[model samples]
Target: MPQATALYTAKTKRCEARKKKRRMTEPTQTESPDTTPLILDVDGTLLRTDMLYESLWAAAGRNIAATLKTCVTQWRAPNLLKHALCEIAAPNVALLPLRPAVLDLADAARQAGRAVHLASGSDQALVEAVAQRLDLPGPHFGSDATRNLTEQSKAQMLVERFGEGGFDYVGNSNADLPVWSKARRIIAVSPGGTLRHRLEAMGKPLEVVEDRSDPFALLREMRPHQWIKNLLLFLPLLVAHEFGLSVFLAALMAAAAFSIGASAIYILNDLLDLESDRLHPEKRNRPIASGALQIRNAMIASAGLVVLALTSAWLVGPPVAALTLLYMLTSLTYSFWLKKRRWIDLASLAFMFLLRVLTGAVAAQIAVPGVVMAFVFVVFFTLACVKRMTALARDVDHGKLPGRGYGADDFRALKVLAAAGIVLSAAAFLLYAFSGHSGGLYGSQMIFAATVLPLTLWLFRVVRLSELGREDYDPIQFVTHDRIGLMIMVIGVALVILSL
Candidate 1:
């Protein structure tokens, strides 16, 4: 009983000491009377991104269930969650995006001889690392294992240390309103519309940092352009030569379901790939990595999309709903695990493409032949190879180190696979046309010959572009915009409709 009591007493004393240390974090001296003591908010003020969310997703990327468990257990103590995630995910501070204007503001304050300090709700160690990396002067304040120094806590701390109105604060959200109420000068960065209104309600003079992001950043986050790949959901209709309005509507419904499901996967993939995406030349500018959209919003969007996907698939029928669930499960697995595995990632992507065709058949009640399915799979598999090969070859040319399985020399073997895929697809297309099955449905069997011409032209063109190191762009997106690729699509679609 005495030993147990002694252990409890020791733990109580340590906790008290930690709290005392945090309470006394204020600098003993504000340096000079002339110092206005400029304070910077870390997340949305100085950085284009938020570290807490970045860390959360980074940790989640490794082991989502374990991360979720830790977060849930620490929910009652928000500060503990902050501390745990800091240790588990500790963001790549160097790669984190910073606002140029915010940096300039800090620089000006320092040059004017103001005492600059960083204070954030992010973990103490993480915030200090950021301050060090930015070469900022600070008696920095941050959340600890016991206290999340944010909003009210942060305002109270600064008020006690510097007295009301003694310091200037730079902040960006509604959470910063409390701190701003006590600050001498209010500097806001990229505040949302409602936050802007609330900032005005304070009746304090506002200094705004103009946002230069695209207006469609949210839409870009959804990646509607990538939905073009989901048009594969119409392949079964096209191959079966079903042009009835009802069948087309069913295919359209199925397409919508698959596309929405794919978007959810895209958002999830972007979250998991956040760190690596920040290192990539083109991908670094993605909405998530570039901080154009918040991770919380992205998660909510993913959930909503999944719900919509299932609803739409159910409207199509039971078969399509089941297929949609399968696609989502396969894609989630690919995003969490298979994406980093070499050839498996390619195979998974190809299978996803094939699933679209299968769902289209089920949705439209078409009896597409096995040969046609093989053709569709090979076509998409070749496109997947093109996508992977172009990216690796581009990375190698740019002198960036490769990750997620393939190396610099791996693009060559992918090129071979892409060529083999194209050859096999062509063979399948020819076999289907000559089987005398297509002739009974279409006005002319010669339509397949004409359709193959444009497809062959597009496939060979994409391959040559990959060889020339000019295919750095997303192969799917490129098809939507490229002049020749667009022409090929137009010709192919027109030929099919004309034959019908």
Candidate 2:
């Protein structure tokens, strides 16, 4: 009996020694005055953008077909989708838009002898890369093939690691609600109105980090100023001398429809070009590239705009609707495929502008002379080339233009081609004026012919400005904003009106 007791005592002592060893190795609640670690939510908290979406954009940019295939294959496995996207994307950590305030807070916490951890729903590899790039001190926890570490899962992990109410959480979205409830302190970074309301309801002490987002961020994303380009839809109505109320209304509706569709395409382009835009000098300020707008919200807005555009197109007429559909399909093709093809991209832009005129003609039920259409095509093509040349000048030092499949050597060729296009445009305009079409439409052929002089001067000025590297990348934008271009436009319009 004594031997058995001795054995039991020996087993008890062994267990006690093991417990003591664990106590020595594990961190204690009182290890330091700042025992609670700062747990950062990577997406929208530590970083201004979501890494998962950023990775998806990069993957799509690399090979859209492969990215789509991977997404389909892993539709039911989000963690695997994230991993696959990360592998394909291989994002540059230094280029990501990080929130300075959140980063400063994390650094301060670390300096205060508190642990700092990055907890995110992003793939493990992506999280590790960002943490390492920022030189973060603590370990990172991220989603893997089996689990997506977010919301409740993130809260559960923190509770398991540090115990409930033992850590501080920094997050931005409503999804962080559960984690915030579990955290001892809530640090809100750019919390929206709904999140602010919820935090107030919780009656918990909170630290607010201002987002510094532009107040007109959504409008900027929609690019309302770019809608001015859709005025091309009115050219046919004006040139055909159809000023009746019905024709005017149809043209207006067509313009609105095109604007809506163009805005949708712009949003999609921004999403696809996020990585490339981040590398660009000026384009990096775009709302999506700068992380001022969320990807999911942008996607929703784009879808909504497309629906509105289609509905408005249908209201105009069947032919107008068909033309609008064609424009959308062509634009989609350009965004997805042709935009990456050097010369083809310029041709596609010119074609889209011509389609706007065609749409206007259909909406107004007016005939546009074939020669006039040819002039429009050539002029728009020259302008498109000029835009490309300006972009090439800016990006030549990089050897290759971002998002565009053009090399530095192509600049001289593009300039030569643009000059040829300008000559062709002038010839087309002269042919239209002398071919008797203008005499049939206008009271005086000489007056109509005189309009070409201002047009030539305007085109020359545009080309010279572009060559001097003093033009906007968008030629239409430059024409709309430049004082000399606007003056020339007004004079040309006045001459055309006199001829009519």
Candidate 3:
């Protein structure tokens, strides 16, 4: 019996050894080397598309303002603009903008032989487009392949793709912390607040890339040169022969007040559009959109600004106050409502420009000349058309305008509007030169005409450039800093002042 048992045991040991050898000889599916991957978020981390929102807002402002005069509820404004822009310029529209730094980092990682993956909550298509642009190879782990990658969904994706030994993550927000914690190495991008401090306490390795500053961003949002219409508000004072220093000072005050109020409106607009802006390519990093400034904080700042605006208006008296209210109403309507309407939207925008001139006149206690009023309307309409035409051109160049709702058809419309603007603009300049007022404003009739020729040519050139998508500028910055335009403008202004 003992001999039989020993024999069986020996045979079992031999069989086990043979099986082990066979397993070792054959290739198995199990991996030996572990992989550490880098996961990045889409909205705040990889790319920003806030500019798309601003552009859409601008388009909406042109289209929506013609309807109701009283404030439109917030709910209506959001959907109205979203639907309108999507319908008008869908080709250039996209979910979000891509960040160059994020791509740079991904490239750096690839060069360093680090595995790269995107763990985002954005739509797979949008993120993939961004990844492709960045040359990222991914079995992506994030939200629905089609929707946005966000919050808890992003963390789960990391686990689903790599399980335990699959990745080390890099990200910029608390939303990423869940996956970051699971990561072998956590490379934090633009870390801050509780998450930053918590990660530090946990002794995680963190890397920070500061956001870039864009000075022209705000001016782009507000379309500042449009403020030139504010100068019209002073026309009444000029006609009243109240062009004295006091009236001039009052007019200046109103302009300043309107600007401040307008800026405050911009902040609010950014806040309301924050989510949509996050998906924009250029606008995502806006001071308001990038999470650098909290919405609560932004609201507080806006309130403070409004208080200052009201104080300035009050100091200027009832006429100034009333005009300020009108300005605020117009701007707010643009920000919230009229921006969603179509041609009516454009009409309202033109009216707002005309009103700015009227306000200046009222604040200064004067009656604006009929020619000046006509000129303001014509010039403003032409410029508005130019602005729309530029946007349409951008949509064409980009192939599509997403989220904002514009399409190729809209681009065609913008082209037509721009052409109309050119014709009307030429007409306005001619009218300005030939009108009887040329003698009073320019000194010599011929002097005004000469200035008009240059001014008209300059305007045409700018419109053409804008239509060609050459001037991808915030209107204010373009008008104020474009040396060529500024120099020509100076000559035109000098001619006008000399004539006066």
Q: What are the per-residue Cα lDDT tens digits for candidate 2 across 13-47?
A: 99999999999999888543776899999988888
- Every model's TM-score: 0.86, 0.89, 0.58
Off by over 4 Å in 3: 1-34, 49-95, 104-116, 121-166, 193-197, 205-229, 243-246, 264-322, 328-346, 385-500
38-144 per-residue lDDT for model 3 (tens digits):
67766556755433243344444444443222124322343343333434333122334456677787777777777887765533444465566666678664334
Candidate 3: residue 363 lDDT (0-100):
73
Among all windows of 10 consecutive residues in model 2, the one with the lowest summed lDDT is 27-36
User: How good is model 1 by TM-score?
Assistant: 0.86
Shift of residue 277 alpha carbon in model 1, Å = 2.1
- Models sorted by TM-score, best on top: 2, 1, 3
| Tens-digit lDDT track of model 1 for 169-232 | 9998889999999998889987888988888888887888886666677689888988888788
Candidate 1 — what's its lDDT? 0.85
| Cα RMSD to the true fold for all candidates | 17.1, 12.3, 11.6
**Number of colliding residue pairs in each model:** 0, 0, 69
lDDT of candidates 1 onward, in order: 0.85, 0.86, 0.63
